[model samples]
Target chain A: MKLEIELIYKQYVDYIYGFIYGMVQNKAVAEDLLQDTFVKVMKSDIDKIENMKAWLITVARNTVYDHWRREKRKLNLMPFIRRKRRDIDLKLDIERGIEKLSPKLKEVIILREINQLNYKEIADILDVEIGTVKSRLNRARKELRDSLEG
Target chain B: MNCSKIEELLSPYIDGELSRDEIIRVERHILECKNCEELLKDFQLIKEKVRGIEIPQPSLRIKKKIIGYARPRNYFLRIIFSTSLLTGLGALLVLTLGHQPYIAEEKPKEYYIMKEERTPYMEILYETEGDYILTNYEGGSL
Candidate 1:
């Protein structure tokens, strides 16, 4: 069991971490989600997962969405308070542009670009059609380019 | 292929996801259409920038924590092994002290206070057991 986990960790840790970090954009939260993702993997029946990388990414994405949903609920209960915005860093323009994208587009971009997954792999991870993945990737790039330029 | 269709294909072309026929068609269209060419460049730039964003690695501590959590039996064994080692050491210490009344001294606990200004949305303050206070302000508090 230990060897199995070590092997899986060696193979997928960085990819899973990158995917979660892209989704959450917070180091601490991303690390927590990464931990949660691995724990889920450890608990799951490994023999059943035919595509390990895609399965891991799917789990990571779901963990991120679960975190977001929990945060949204907490925000709903909290009193509204206005806060000052920090100056945007020029170096982070592209990242911020990605952050500005809609969730669907942002996810496709992350899976494709950051994680370097192919369209078919991304489709498998996202449970979407390959055509949908292509369109989303195209739309995501266009939106990101426009945001950076504007 | 028209410019709009070619534009849509630009991302796939950059990703090397296009088939032989589609790639030939998009390349032919891009060579003639300046707008599509520029759009292709923009897509390539976006891909580069997204790929360039540094992905932070999860810390070793987090990795150990996850592993420990996943395999609680191993962790429990570790705890037991360490405790046993400590107990054996303590037993040796007592055996060597033989009738020399040993007085245990309590050391004063040291406290560290930290204040961090993060973004601007949320402020959190907490106190440690040793009277150390930490105040943290973070932006985009959910």
Candidate 2:
């Protein structure tokens, strides 16, 4: 309710949305989870939070993982396809490549490249050591190379 | 380190995350190794492709929907709490107060079962008043 928190929400809403949308690849679900993320932040005691951005990303990442677990049970019977819109089709191809990544590698690539979070930020979000974050990122890059090439 | 070691570090090297010493080693190795040189080209190609791909913007409807959820966070939670309280009270009332009217509305039918406890003894025969009877075991006059 404070002016600062409201301003923060307004400023970062789009960035958080873009980051989550990149992970989920669905507009409706992404929007729902985005609202959920902000709602959680607003309800939490901010005095305890040292890094708001990393905390928000961590919340968004958990929401995405839960969504994935729920959807995986639904057993999607449809084959993956690049939709007809030229730009979207191309984008969809890139998305498919990201989807093909192992979960660990995918998370690293998404946090670093798509979310544009620094290595230290990603390290905090994932609750891993910095060296582990760097190594995972490197492996992710190599895997993305193989996916794009083959 | 050998070509394999340098090749393993190429991704981190490109990301500018490697230590200064590792950077120098990797750079020196790539200068001599053509295979790793090709690997670097392939890595760059992938990074460019991923970075260049445009991310789709969230639709306007989704934007409005998300904003709608955020706008009523406090009010929505209040409503949920009140509704839950009402639901619990209603259940308590229904459970505490027995369903008298509900049970009264429907009449239960009655059923009976028949059983015999004992049977009477049967009479074997009857004798006329004027008729004389003699016992076979002893002689008698009547």
Candidate 3:
């Protein structure tokens, strides 16, 4: 059991932590949640999880939501960032622009671009159809562009 | 297809996720529609930029901690230590109450004060005790 858990942690620590920190955007919070996530994985029946990446993602995402709920602070407020375009060519405040996005839209964007998960993988993580992933990304990009354009 | 229809496919088009038929349709439409051409440009550019911002990697310390979860430890020792500690404390409290017949007369006010002061701590103790009971029931030391 010890070797099994260590192997899984060694293999996916980077991948899991990146996804968590990408969502939270905080190093300290991410670190705590990373430990919590691993604790959960250790306690669970690890051999039963066929798709480790997806399962880990689902657990991490819920852990983040649970943290937010405990704090009573969701990512509703546009965090304070300068309204400078993130793109060299476009006029979007990349950080502010993403914060402006609805959480659902922002999630799909993060899963796709930051995690580099394809639509199918994202679909599995979000528990939505593949078509929903495509549409959400479409809306998210459009909103991101419109936020910049205006 | 009109620009709206083409716009829906543009994101997938950039990702090469569209069906061949949808791909042909989006490509043909974007060629003629300047608005959609720009939209596709923005989607691709934004996707690239979002990917550009570095994700926070696990610190070496955090990775070590996570790996430590997999390490074997004597949780049974923890269970025994805590159980014994609580049991000893409970026994001491009961013995003190039994010996102090005079203090027992003043118990109502003291009980109220202690309840007010110690409710939160007692709740925590109760939760821990509940976990211990469950752990024993499950035949696991965790």
Residues B10-108, model 3: lDDT tens digits: 888888888899988988888899988888889988888788877656788777767765745578966887899999999999999899767545534
Model 1 residue-pair collision total: 1
What tens digits encode model 2's per-residue C-alpha lDDT throughout A43-141? 777778787788778877887777677555432532342233442454555677776777777888777777777777788889899878877766777
lDDT of 1 by residue, A1-150 (tens): 557777888888898999888876767678778887887888888878888888888888888888777766655776463333442343388888887888899899999988998888888878889999989998888888889989
Q: Give the best candidate by lDDT.
A: 1
Screening candidate 2 with a backbone cut-off below 3 angstroms (N, C-alpha, C), the clashing residue pairs are none
Superposed by TM-score, candidate 2 places the C-alpha of residue A36 at a distance from the truth, in angstroms, of 2.6
Candidate that would win on DockQ: 1
* Candidate 2 vs 3: which has more DockQ: 3
Tens digit per residue, CA lDDT, model 1, B32-86: 9899989998888888889999887889988886666544348788799789999
Ranked by TM-score, the better of candidates 2 and 3 is: 3
Task: In model 2, state the lDDT of residue B74.
Answer: 68
Instruction: Assess candidate 1 and give its TM-score to the true structure.
Output: 0.76
- Once fitted onto the true fold, the runs of candidate 2 whose alpha carbons sit more than 4 angstroms away are A2-5, A76-92, B70-142
- Every candidate's chain B TM-score: 0.54, 0.51, 0.50
Residue A83 deviation, candidate 2, in Å?
A: 11
**Poorest lDDT segment (10 consecutive residues) of candidate 1 chain B:** B133-142
RMSD of each: 6.2, 27.4, 10.5
TM-score of each: 0.76, 0.66, 0.69
DockQ-derived CAPRI band for the predicted complex in model 3? acceptable
